[model samples]
Target chain A: MNKRELFAQIQEKKSFLCVGLDPVMENIPKHLLKYEDPILEFNKQLIDATKDLCVAYKPNTAFYESMGWKGWRTLTETWKYIPENIFTIADAKRGDIGNTSAMYAETFFNREKSEMGFDAVTVAPYMGEDSVGPFLNYKDKWVILLALTSNSGHKDFQVLETGGQKLYETVINTSSGWATADQLMYVVGATRAEEFKQVRKLAPDHFLLVPGVGAQGGSLADVCEYGLNDSCGLLVNSSRGIIYAGKGEDFAERAREEALKLQQEMEQILLSAELI
Target chain B: MNKRELFAQIQEKKSFLCVGLDPVMENIPKHLLKYEDPILEFNKQLIDATKDLCVAYKPNTAFYESMGWKGWRTLTETWKYIPENIFTIADAKRGDIGNTSAMYAETFFNREKSEMGFDAVTVAPYMGEDSVGPFLNYKDKWVILLALTSNSGHKDFQVLETGGQKLYETVINTSSGWATADQLMYVVGATRAEEFKQVRKLAPDHFLLVPGVGAQGGSLADVCEYGLNDSCGLLVNSSRGIIYAGKGEDFAERAREEALKLQQEMEQILLSAELI
Candidate 1:
């Protein structure tokens, strides 16, 4: 999806929320195990319950990959199930050299080859431009480059003072040249709310896929205050808080309740910010 | 494999050559298309031909993942086919948060879970300590961190001066504290030959998985000159230069011939250093 189409979806849905489909078998409801593929069933219900409340669905590939080929098949099926109007992101932090990265691009963006074409794929920026360039080759696809991550390890190297600027700043600054905001987005963790202000200055027009709102203790208000742009350029992702909200037979309804709450809050924010 | 076992393999084979199995279906010999799974056949033949010459096999996951579930199955089968004595590396440059990284660790390290138990998996260092910590939880499994890459984009952010040290240097120094050299390795591209001296200062004992040796224009002699240590702590990888040596029915033989040439060079280097 292009920036305009994504912004349109956010405006139409009244929420910039991106529900994370990181379903672990151990965490899914016990009753759902009766299904042939419990994870796929869980994911389908979650998508069904929350599709109207969110503008995108971000699936962290590790959750599926850990389960082997069966899990990969589930991931492909889940991607196919997501509504076309709502954006999809393969939160697979992949990056390599030019040619190798091209294969990764084909994996996430070429539907004919990979059986699933996500609108965007989160990429690690450590490998630099060439590693990120191949993803940008696909005309409408997005490359959500990791900038300021939410993990405690974020301080280990990202915050280091590099050439009078922090490493994350250098990443945002240097990587801006690789692609425009239309095709590029940054993964700026919501846990680092204060850094959002600094990041907004560097990437005034680019979208930021913000993870760490509920389960990770990041405040939605704080993220919106600093991270939001005229186009509502922030995709706040909530995984455990919504999908695993309840484990009963009414799990999907409970997930909708959780998503509805976030959507309501996002609606208020969007209204106040005049983004809708 | 453990550090001692890896070094023993290197000494026994008299080579530290690592053959990169990055097979593109379009690039493989036309005759191989007769096989039920041509990519798997190609990988098997490549592994068979170079198994004796090289001590390690590094398959960049993108090459297989691009083909979807079938490709993933090929990767699993290929992993099962490799000789147990030789070290296997899932050159999947993966890293995420603590919990997410645990899933990634399971995907590559836990054979029971992912069906592909690799001795080492290359990880991107941008996410910090927690992102890399989970992989170290597995016994005898290695986390080969990306320190300095071979691509032209490496100059973008990796070389940025951070607190008087380059970003890659900071990655090596900070991450060295996360795990012991026995479990941790760094990827120092052969293209940056001069940087080998600087890298060695920070990580003298840690093995460096050096790519860009041949196809990327990195000289093997230059890499070995400043990069090699007492245990010959280097795994020089060659993908296109060796695997795609010939496109005809005799491709496997040609690949062996190419691998033999590199093995011969590595053997001479080991002999001259008196490390064999």
Candidate 2:
């Protein structure tokens, strides 16, 4: 989806919430164990509950990959389940050399080849332009490049100064030349709200996929305050916080409640900013 | 496999050559198309033919992922088909937050959970210590961190100076604190032959999984000149150059011939260095 279409969805929904469908088998409700693929069922119910409250659904590929080939089947099915109007992100942190990266692009963007195509893919920018270039080759498919992650290790190399600017800044600045904001977005952690200002300066028009809310102790208010643009360019993801909200058969209902709380807050934020 | 076992295998085989099993469906021989999974068949035959010739097999995960669920199964089966003595690397350049990265670790390293227990996995260092720490937690497993890649985009951020050291150098120096040479390795491309000299100084004992030696325009002799240590601390990878050597019914034999040439050259390199 393009920026205007995504913005229109956020405006109509009055929320920029992106529900994370990261289902762990052990964390799943016991009643789900009766199903052939418990995780897929868990994901479908979660999507059913929260699809209206969120603008996008982000499925981190690591969780599915952990279950082996069966998990991959679950992942593919999960993608098929999410509503097409809701932006879908295959949070597959993949990047490699140009040729290999083209295959990754084909994996996530070309549904004809990979059996699933996502609206956007989370890519690691360590390999630089050529690696990220292949993904941008897909028109309207987004490449959310990693920049200032919310994890504790963010200070390791990302915050280090390269020349006069920090590494993440260099990443944002250098990679901006490779693609316009229409095709590119940045993964800036909600945990580091302070970095959001610096992130905005470099990527003013680009949308930022914010993680680290809820379970990771990131303040949604703080992220919105510094990260939001006129278009409400933020897709704040909350995985463990919402999915594991309940352990009973009413798990989906509980997840909806949790998503409702976030969506309400996002609606308020949009109102206060006069974005809605 | 541990450091000692890997070195011993190189000495026993007299070849530190690592044959890359990155299969593409369009590239496979038409004769193998009769099988249920031609790619898996291609991989099995490649492993069967090169098991004795090369000490390692690095399957770049992108090619498998591009085929969707079937591709993931091919990856699992390919990992299972390789001989126990040969080092296996799921060249999945993956990294994320702590918990997510742990799932990736399970995806590639934990056989009980994922059914594909690879000895080593190529991890991206963009997310820092916590993202990479989980992979090191696995006993006898390896984390070959991306340091200096072989791609043209490697110069984008890797070569930039960060706090008196290049980004890739800082990556090496800081991540070295997370794991020892036994459990940790680095992906230093053979394309940048000069950078190998700098890499060896920081990591004298660590095994470097060197790609870009064949189709990527890297010379084995040049990589060995500056990158080699007493234990022959390098696994030179050649994917397209070796795998697609022939296209007919005798494709496996042609692959063997290509592998044999590299193995013979590696044996000579080992002999001249008196390491065999």
TM-score of 1: 0.99
Instruction: Please write out the lDDT profile of model 2 over residues B1-276, one tens digit for every residue.
Output: 999999999999999989898889999999999999999999988888888999999999999999999899989989998888889999999999999999999999999999999999999999999999999998999999999999999989999998778989988999889999999999999989988999999999889999998888899999999988987899999999889999988888999999999999999999999997
Per-residue lDDT for B1-276 in model 1, tens only?
999999999999999999999999999999999999999999999988889999999999999899997888889999999999999999999999999999999999899988989999999999999999999999999999999999998988899888888889989999999999999999999999999999999999999999998899999999988999998999999999999999999999999999999999999999999998
Model 2 residue A93 distance off true place after TM-score fit, in angstroms:
0.9
Candidate of highest DockQ: 2
Interface RMSD, candidate 2?
0.6
TM-score of chain B of 2: 0.99
TM-score of 2: 0.99
- Docking quality level of the chain pair in candidate 2: high
Q: Please write out the lDDT profile of model 1 over residues A1-276, one tens digit for every residue.
A: 788899999999999999999999999999999999999999999999999999999999999999997888999999999999989999999999999999999999999999999999999999899999999999999999999999999999889898788989999999999899999999999999998999999999999999999999999999999999988989999999999999989999999999999999999999999887
* After superposition, candidate 1 runs with Cα above 4 Å error: none
Error of 1 at A80 (Å): 0.2
